[model samples]
Target: MNSSLRSDANTIIERSIQAVLPDEAVRRALSGRKFSGRVLLVAAGKAAWQMASAAAAQLGDGLSAGVVVTKYDHVKGDIPHCTCYEAGHPVPDENSFAATQAALDLVKDAGEGDTVLFLLSGGGSALFEKPLVSGEELQNITGQLLACGADIVEMNTLRKRLSAVKGGRFAQLCAPAKVFAVVLSDILGDPLDMIASGPACPDSSTCAQALAVVEKYHLTLSDAAMECLKQETPKQLDNVETQITGSVRQLCAAAAQVCRQLGYEPVILTDQLCCQAKEAGSFLASIAKTHARPEHPMAFIAGGETVVQLTGKGRGGRNQELALAAAEGIAGMDNAAVFSVGSDGTDGPTDAAGGYVDGSTRAALLAAGLTVHGVLAENDAYHALQKTDGLIVTGPTGTNVNDVALALVR
Candidate 1:
């Protein structure tokens, strides 16, 4: 492994994540916004805790009440008047229902003069849900979509149909009251309706599109779920005003800035990378092989979320899988390394944020009787990277824009 390259990668990761944190963004968004009566804050997703905290500090005694629902272990501390609840992510669970109910209740009796300060981010589909179907069925359907490699847009399209709070329904529930939403986009292109299933934004996706996703994935859904898919989400909403504060584009820019500071000429390949994790890794390695010049440091960056088609039962996330898959293509390159990490600081179900690979990583794994192909086939990049000391762990980054993958050549 190239220690210097690894250090640079770590610096880029840290600085970039810090740049995209929602604290300043939230404060700025709320600065000039005026509220008539009540400003009831409802924050949901991975950044819910952080966004809520910032809003609480900004609003102070002005905030009438607040509710925060975020991924488990994400609630760092208490926010002044807000009731904080830690819930499940990627799949809604019992706590998800409870926390969502609390938010719903907080806004249910809202008057026309009241304002719902809805702070939304990625993972809100699961963290801020009131399922129309049974909770068990919802979990099963979510698992099926995940296993079949449905992308975030597709997953949320189907998920919004099955939930009472998604697809602009939450905004409807907070009806008569205006909603001022500060959104942190995690999806490529920053589609407002698709982020966190767009609880407050008008859903552009149709019922046909929802059914198409189900058919594409061959997802086995309950009868009630199928019925929900046939129902159309709200096509238009007038009570909500949205301000998009951050996105993967910002994440990529931050990384590129750090790369330039590290004396590397940075090229942003794309900010909309969406494909199979393994294929993306291999493609990035190919770019490194074709572009790297001797003694001329360069950084190639791609920022977007990738999908993993699960054919194996092992544990891993898309970022981890992407990094591990790059191991073989750049195995003999002394000055090349590839790494990918989730902005949320958690990859799949593992503790590691992502994985890293360089020229020596392959050999180290082989020395431990592990082959890249074998580990990847089992979908166990977490353990494989662990054996090679290639796992990148950043616990609960308090933000979620997307994943950023980089190929470093020095």
Candidate 2:
């Protein structure tokens, strides 16, 4: 491994995550916003706890009552006047239902002149759900969509129709009251109506589109689920206004800043990087080879989410798969390395944020009886990375802004 380059990558990753934490962003979004009557807070997603804490601190006595529904282990502490519940992510569980019900109950009492301060972030679709279909069916459908490698937009489009709280239905429940939504975008283009299935914003997806996704993916759905998708979601909402706090673009910019500070000439390839996990890694590795002889050290950055098709039952995430796949391409280039991480600090079902791969990674893994193709085919980047000490663990970063992948050539 190139220790210096790895060190630089770690520096960029830590500082970049710090730059996007929702503490300051939430406070900034709440500034100058006027609220009347009762101001209730409903926070959801991986970053919900931190966002709620910062908002509670800012709103103080003004926050009448609040409910926080986040991923399991995300609630770090108590937020006064607010109840926090940790649920599931990537998929919603029974706990998700109960916590979402709490949020709904909190907002259902909103008066005509009241304001519902809805703090939203990525992963909310699963963490903030009130499923219209049976919970079992919802889980099955979600798993199918995931296994089929559906993108965020496609997944959320189908999710919005199946959930009572999504597709602006939550805003409807807070009817006669205004909803001020603070969002942290994890999807490309910052589509307010799509992020986290847009619980507060009116959904832009149509019944046909939802059906199209099911058809395109050849997803098997229950009769009840099919009916739900056939029903159209709310296309417009009058009582909701939105403020986007951060996104992948900011993540890329922050990484670039850190790279420059560390003396690497950074090039932000794109903030809209959307592709298969392995494909992205291979492409980045190819870039490293293309610039193998640069006069100065260089960093290439790509920020956004990637999809992974389930070929095996082994545990891993898109970010981990991305990093591991790059190993082969840069196998003997001692000065090259590639790493990818989810800003949320948890990737897939694993506790790791992501994985890293230096030029020596391929050889080291082979020495340990692990081949990149064999490991990746089982969708088992986590264990393979563990063998090479390549996993990146940064438990519960209290933020979500898609992901960042980097290629360092020194």
Candidate 3:
């Protein structure tokens, strides 16, 4: 019975990922749209290659010049009529700077009648950036923001001010040319200004908000980065059309369907679950504990991005930590299981998509001489899950819609 439940959980997660892939979403968005003149493609994010490849299939020979910047190893293969570059994600590297420069150059030369097809997805804020400050200073500030436990919105609020191409600046660079952005949103509320720092959409975040984040986190920034934070981002954008092709809401719906098919009563807890990683895990486990029964089977689904305040020096993503915490909460509930996975198939800096924990997970760890509390306290869920075979390694799924977490009770 436990094995069957695990299989069902995996199937639901896979269905959720498939539902939000950029390929189908981009193709559907471009079905009736027609461009008169040249189409310049610029894509950036974890799903950049997949989205750009899908758009290329539709544009055919109409695509003039294009640039694709994606996370390292996310570039599956060559994108026809487009140059693909792999860059750092969660943190911008030197390659990210160079590739973003190329993307800006491609859009800068767009003529009056041309169309700039911006293929955006999650992680673009880091994958596509030309900093207003030096590369070293930019990297330093980004590291500080991440380690400071700031949420995506808070981190992006500061990023918009620090980047030369963010906060509608990229759209401004492509002035006179119509800009249409097909986005695969990984943001909690699907805020256009927050996704990828709103390179092609107007930024609603002000310098004051950015400053507040810095003060809240007590982040120490370089002089140049500090100065950039005081400057204003572009609050207005011209000739830009933004369309959200995929989101966490869609991901949760797909997972719920799969759960129903698997003979579990599907309950969507919330599609906009925003909280600390461990807190989210504990909450889901609490639901599982309440519903766990021999005769009753239920699946609780939640989707959204979760933040993690890094207090330990050990390694693990937010999803991994969430699963570990759930393990503790559901330790004695024999029929309960909880799983969390990022839609992009890479959570935090780890190769694992996320983590999974069953009622036996905690005991299994103890049998193996591992302490759940100690592992979680050190933020070492990756190694702990690996020992218990709780790590879900899906590699890159070529999609991004934040994260989907499910707790099943039988």
Candidate 4:
């Protein structure tokens, strides 16, 4: 393995993550905004704590009662007067329902002339949920959607229909009070109505659209859940303003800058990347194979989340699967390396952030009596990458933008 190349890649990724942190983005988005009367804060999702903390720092005493619900371990410290709660993610638990109810009450009680500042980011769908159906039914449907490889948009479409605060219902609950949201988008294209299931923005999805997603995924839902899916989400929301503060586009650009500094000609392939994890890795390897030169190193960067269809019981996330697939394409090539990371610093249910692999990775696996095809076929990239020291573990990065992939050929 080329240690220098791996180090450079890690550095590039770290810099990329720093560029889109919720604190800086929130601070910039709220600058020059004037507010009247009491300001109530409701922050939700993976970056809720960071976003709320930054806003509290800026608003100080102007900020009144507040509540934050985020993924487990996201809370860094106290946010002055805000009460922070860690909830379940990728799946909702009892805490998810409880915390969401608290947020709903806070918004519902806001009177006229009051300002509701919502700090939203990715993972809100699972992190903040008040289901129209039973919690067990909601969990079952979510698992079915995920196992069948439903994309974020499709999954969220169904979620909006089954949720109380999502799909503009939260904004509706705030009524006469002015609502302003600063969002850190983790969705491709930054669809304002889709991020975090559009809690405070107008939802454009229809009941028919949600039903279509269920049909597309062949999802089996309980009668109650199915009945809820037929209900329309809030289609229009008034007295609400929104600003998209961060996205994968900025994440990719930041990585490109670091690549250039490392003496590589950076090529940003796409920030809208979305596909099967293994297929995306193979595609990136194709790019490296075509452009790699001995004289000039090249860095290919892409950003966006990918889906994993769980066909195997083996443990692995999409990013790890992607890198392991790339290892196959660049097995014998020298100075070719590939790495992918979830901007939130966790991939799937694993503690590892993602995976990294290079030309030497395949041979190393063979020496350890492991084969790429075997590991990937079982969907066990985590263990395979661990054997080659290719796992990238960065616990709870305190932010969530999206997933990023980088291919370096030198």
What TM-scores do the predictions have? 0.99, 0.99, 0.98, 0.98
Model 2: how far residue 127 lies from native, Å: 0.5
**Local lDDT at 35 for model 4:** 84
Question: lDDT at 383 for candidate 3?
Answer: 90
Per-residue lDDT tens digits of candidate 4, residues 1-410?
A: 88998899789878889877888778887888888888999999998998999999998898998999998877889998799999988998899999989988887878889999999999999988999998998998888988888999999999988988899988988888989999989999999889999999888988889988988878888888888888777777778999898899999998898899999999999999999999999998888888767578989998999888887788889999999989988888888999999998888888888999998999999999989888877888998998899999888887888999999999
Worst 10 residues of 4 by lDDT: 286-295
lDDT of each: 0.93, 0.93, 0.89, 0.89
Residue 382 in model 4: shift from native, Å?
1.5
Candidate with the larger lDDT of 1 and 4: 1
List where candidate 1 sits over 4 angstroms from the true fold.
none
lDDT of 4 at 197: 94
Backbone clashes for every candidate come to 0, 0, 0, 0
Give the least accurate 10-residue stretch of model 1, judged by summed lDDT.
Answer: 287-296
Model 1 score (lDDT): 0.93
Instruction: Report the lDDT tens digits of candidate 3 across residue range 1-410.
Output: 16776787788888778877888789888998989989999999999999999999987888888999999889888877999999988989999999999988887778999999999999999999998988887788888888877889999999889898999999999999999999989998789999999999988988889989989988888777778888887777769997898888999998998888888888999999888899999999998877767466788998988888777788889999898889888997768899999999998889999999998899999988888778877888899899888888888999999899999988
